[model samples]
Every structure is written in C-alpha cells, then in structure tokens.
Target: MNTTKRPIVTGIDGSGEALDAVRWAGRAARLRDVPLEIVHALDFPALLAGGVVPPPEEMKDTLRAHGQRYLRAAQEIAEAQGTTAVTTRLDPDRAAQALIEASRTAALVVVGSGGRGRLTGLLAGSVASAVGAHAACDVVVVRGDSWDDPEVADRPVVAGIDGSEPSARILAAAVAEARARKTRLVVVHASADEPRPETEPHLDPQAATEAGEQLLGELTGEHEAGGITVERVVVRGHPRRELIERSATAQLVVLGDRGRGGFPGLLLGSTGQALLHNAACPVYLVRTVS
Candidate 1:
C-alpha cells in the first residue's frame, strides 16, 4: 500500500503515557490524512505467569473487557485530534511484538516514553524500547517529558545525521515535519571524533568545517529553497550528548535506523538507544524505502 494511506498505529497498554501516544498518533493521522489505529495487546502470557492452575474463563473476559475499555479511551483521544478515520484493535500478543506486527503495514508506529504495566499490564517503557528498535516503518516514541511544555511547542525539529548518504533522508524528513509544524529544521552533525577519511593522515579542521557546511548546504537547498527555514550545525562532540541537549528544546528529533555519525552506531548504535530513552521530545526513527 502507498505509505500515505497507511494508518498511523499506536499501542496502548492503559497507561497515561500510552494515552499521550494516542494523542500524538491521532495528530499525525490527521496531518497525514490517514486513519488512526489504537491497539491494545491482551498479554495473557504476562498475566498467566506465576500462576499454577489456569485462571477461570471469567478472568479472560475481564482482561478482554479491560482491553476494550482502554481502546475506547484511546479512540476518544485520537478523535479529539480531528481525525475521523479512527480504528481500534485488541490483539492477543505481547505488547512490543504486537506493535511491531502492526508496524509492518503502518505508516508510523507511536508509543509512549514510559509507563508501568497497569490495567492492561503490558508495559510500555520497555515496549517502547523494543518497538523503537524493530519497527518496520517510521517509529515515534512520544515522550511526555517535554512535548507538553509550552516552551518547546515552537522549537525546531532537530535531526541527527551521521554525514552518510542516508543522512540526507533524515534531513528531508525533518524538514517536512518542521514545515508541517511551521517551525525550522536544525540539521545537527556532531561526533566524538571528527569524521575524517582514514586515507587522509592529517585532516584540516577548517577544511572539515567548510566541507561539512557545503554538504549540509547542498543537502538542504531543496528544502530551504522551498521556504522551510533551516539551521545546519556541525560539532566536534558526542552526537548523543549534543542531540540529547537539543532534544530538550526540540519539537521532535529525527534519526536514521542505520544512523551513525562517527560513533560506532547511532540509533542502531549507542546514540540510537541513548536518544530513544533520553530524548526529551519524540524520537523519530526513519527506516523505509523513501
């Protein structure tokens, strides 16, 4: 299916944070003019654990009822985002694995930053980590940490690029999001060790900066020329540290699946996992054909 038509799917485990994710997913669905799917996983395995005899069938009904109740609540939030095309699912699977399955046909999979397993009892913090690590399409781990702060509502959408070819996709996606939010795009390129070709014994700092600037300029020209304002930054520091700081004021942080600036790995690397857990705003992990 065309990505534009694919639903924006979010997993809800009845946690407040999961509700927050539903809100975020609803807005994204409205933005993309697509459907919103709120899924609740009926994790019997989790509930079944530490129990000897099988629970009564009535208990099963209670769990299903709880799942439906959570789904109803999530639907309300999504609808409030002005999305009329909203759907809900009650899946019988583990939380993380269920969302990952939904992601196969979803345009985007959204989850809350952290939550203790409560009513549904499927857990989200760890689920967020797992889904963020394995989702097939783009993934958004919505962090309630700073997204609700009025201070960050107008901040730019910051993107971390490892200065690789795929990094441009991150730039493009970031610009598109920034444009949608009527904000600027901050393209950040930072590394603990300044990226230098092994063949070059001595890399000129000035030349490196100039090259970084040129590459960023070339990459951003299309987006900037289209009227999306951008700020390109290159720093000689740990990409994770720089991005985590910027995430404090960013509307969203965009990174690639194979994103690694100079670090051994980015989102798939050390920076990827760090930012996922630490970024103040939502972290978008892009990994699709586009």
Candidate 2:
C-alpha cells in the first residue's frame, strides 16, 4: 500500500450519478493503493424550505441516515475492490463549499456531472465545476453512460503541454499514471495563429513541428529517465478545441491550471477552464504551487 496521508475524496448525494462517482473513486483508490473518503454534503435548510417541511431534529436524523446509506454503498464498492474506504457527513449549508473544503486533504476530489435536481447536465454540473475551479488538488467530473467503456481500462493517458513550468508537473503526473497503468502516454501541444491574407508566407510548418518536438523531447526525456513511455503530438488550432477533440478518445486528460503566459504562475488559466467545461473524458488539473 502507498500509505499516503491524504485519501481521495468523492462526493455523494444519493443520486445515481453520485453512485457512479463512488464506483470510479473506489477503482482509483484501489489502483493508487490509497485510502478513499466518501463525502455527502447536505443543505438542510434548503431541503426543509424547499417544500418538505420537517422538524429540525427529524431533518437532522433524516440527513444522517441518508448520508450513512450513501457511505455504505461506497464502502461496499471499495470492499469489493479491496481498498480502504471511510465516510464523512458534512452540513456546510452549501454543497460546493463543503466539497472544496474536504478537498484540502484529498489527493483527488471526485464528483458526478449531474444529480437528482433541475440543474442537471448544465455544463459539467455546478458542484463539479465549482470544485474544479477552486480545489487545491485535482478534481474529476464523471459524466455519461460511457463510464462503463472497457477502453477506460486500456486507453492512453493524454496530457496537454505548452512548454510551461507547470507543465513539468503535469507531464510528470501523466507519466506516473501511464507507468502505473502500463499504458501509453500522449503529450499534445496546440499552437495556432491567425492565418495571414494574400501570398504571405505561412508560419513554417517545419519550424512549428521542430519546436513542438523539442519541447516534447524534454518532457519525454524526463519521464523516460524514470522509465515511462510517451508519444508526442502537435496540433494547430484553438487549444481548448484541439484538446477536447483529442479527449473524446482518451482515457484521461491531464492539464495544468496555468502556463507560461504573462501570469503563467497563476493557479487557474483560461485554457484550463475551457477544457474543464468541454473535455469528454475525465479531466485532471495539476496545480503548480509557488
């Protein structure tokens, strides 16, 4: 067992989507040989005020029981996978806030796309988006029935790179995952500039490829030193569009929150936010701490 101090935290709300999140979290925890914490956040006041009027004591007991049920379900999945699993019931008034707080001690925080509410499928789900934007650790937003795809067990781990310092960490993490899974790692870099008018020369394709290859070489060399196999690719278009398109067939896509831009050292970047909302596969964001 890895015996890491922090466990992976998964959000559960008794919804089918949350159950799927639990399943994914269990598999991830087992693969990493780390502990798993199943979390259920409750907004008791909202629940009571939203039609179902229950006494304060009754509401407390009801929420507790519901949380226990969700936890038991998660525990069952973890037990079957032979992984350590724990549960936490939090009533922080706001679901996203509670989940983000829980993420402080989590290796990764997992959440479902949509839940049993009216705001389901509203672009990555509110809770998932919230945590993805603010969590200190990685966040995964699971969506779609394709979660059962067998390719998930054998697919390559894809990561986006732009020759940024934070990309070093992202590339390292991708290599670790690929090595652990005994799978291939794909490093993609998207570079696109506005096309010039008239007979103007193009941005030398050969030059672009060489530059991309050089960056890929550096990233691959670092991973190869650690015995990780990786393939490098360069695409021309919008970073978000290209990455999302590539993610359609990837098992996982790893990205850094910020890159070597003006404020390259920031925790969050525009390209990352775009990918988080649009990527098809589960997205992982690696933060570069200052």
Residue 276: error of model 1 in Å?
1.4
Stretches off by above 4 angstroms in model 1 are 1-4, 47-55, 118-124, 191-202, 261-267, 288-290
Per-residue lDDT over 1-290 for candidate 1, one digit per residue giving the tens place of the 0 to 100 score = 23358898998888888888998888878777888889999876666646556567888899899999999988998899888898899987889899999999998899887765533543237888788778888889897465866677689999887777677777878877887778888998774444556775664667667777777878888777777788999876778899999988888999876654334433355676778767788889887333
Please give the TM-score that candidate 1 achieves against the real structure: 0.87
Question: Best candidate, TM-score-wise?
Answer: 1
Clashes (backbone N, CA, C under 3 Å), per candidate, total 5, 0
What 10-residue stretch in candidate 2 is worst by lDDT? 259-268
What is the Cα-based lDDT of residue 204 in candidate 2? Answer: 76
Error of 2 at 199 (Å): 25
C-alpha-based local distance difference test score of model 2: 0.74
Instruction: List model 2 lDDT by residue over 126-152, tens digit each.
Output: 777777778878777775566458867
Give candidate 2 regions above 4 Å deviation. 2-4, 45-55, 118-121, 193-204, 259-268
Please give the CA lDDT of all the candidate structures.
0.79, 0.74
Best by lDDT: 1
